[model samples]
Target: MKSMPLKLALVAGLGLAFAGATTYAPPASAQVYVTQVGVAPPPPRFERVPPPRYGYVWAPGYWRWDGYRHRHVWVSGYWVHGRPGYVWHPAYWDHAPGGWRFRNGYWAR
Candidate 1:
């Protein structure tokens, strides 16, 4: 009788733990729009390009602005799956009236 109640409690605890784990959601990987006034990102850093990968395109690294640190940070290059009919536009920084604006890489026809 005592053993039965203990087993029941253990099973209930495990079920609750599993239920909590299932409800957890990870943070999104989307980038946020940021505009820095009177600040320009540093020059692009040199990264050794890896050997070509089948059906993939190498996206070069670039300087990314760090808002918290108020400076530029180097983001490493990575391979992206190639799209048959689209071109991969690498991210770049452009001069704007207010400041330097960041344009994200995108696929275009």
Candidate 2:
């Protein structure tokens, strides 16, 4: 008799937890825009860094946001190891309502 009420409460608690988990808000979208000041200078020409192994790849340079200048700064080019089934997207600066925004480079598997 007492166990019946306890079992009902347990089921109701589990149901509420599952419902809350499924109702979580989705992540906000990435903002994209252009900014004149945030443009980065051309990357310096230099000898390419040797790949760690034969299959490694090079990820190119890009600009990053600098808060003090209200502009973007250059992050130099570098080599990265290639993953078996991934592609590297170079980083870039985008203007947004807030200010100049930087999107970091990433390897997409």
The top-ranked prediction according to TM-score is: 1
Kindly list the per-residue Cα lDDT of model 1 for residues 1-109, writing each as its tens digit: 7999999999999999998985554343345354555788877888999999987889999888777898888899998777677777888888988888887776666
User: How do the residues 64-90 of candidate 2 rate in per-residue lDDT, one tens digit apiece?
Assistant: 656688654667777665666666676
lDDT, model 2: 0.62
In model 1, where do residues sit more than 4 Å from their true spots?
A: 1-34
- In each prediction, how many residue pairs overlap at the backbone (N, C-alpha, C within less than 3 A)? 0, 0
lDDT of each: 0.79, 0.62
Candidate 2, TM-score vs. the true structure? 0.45
Model 1: ten consecutive residues of lowest lDDT: 25-34
Give the worst 10-residue stretch by lDDT in candidate 2: 25-34
TM-score of each: 0.66, 0.45
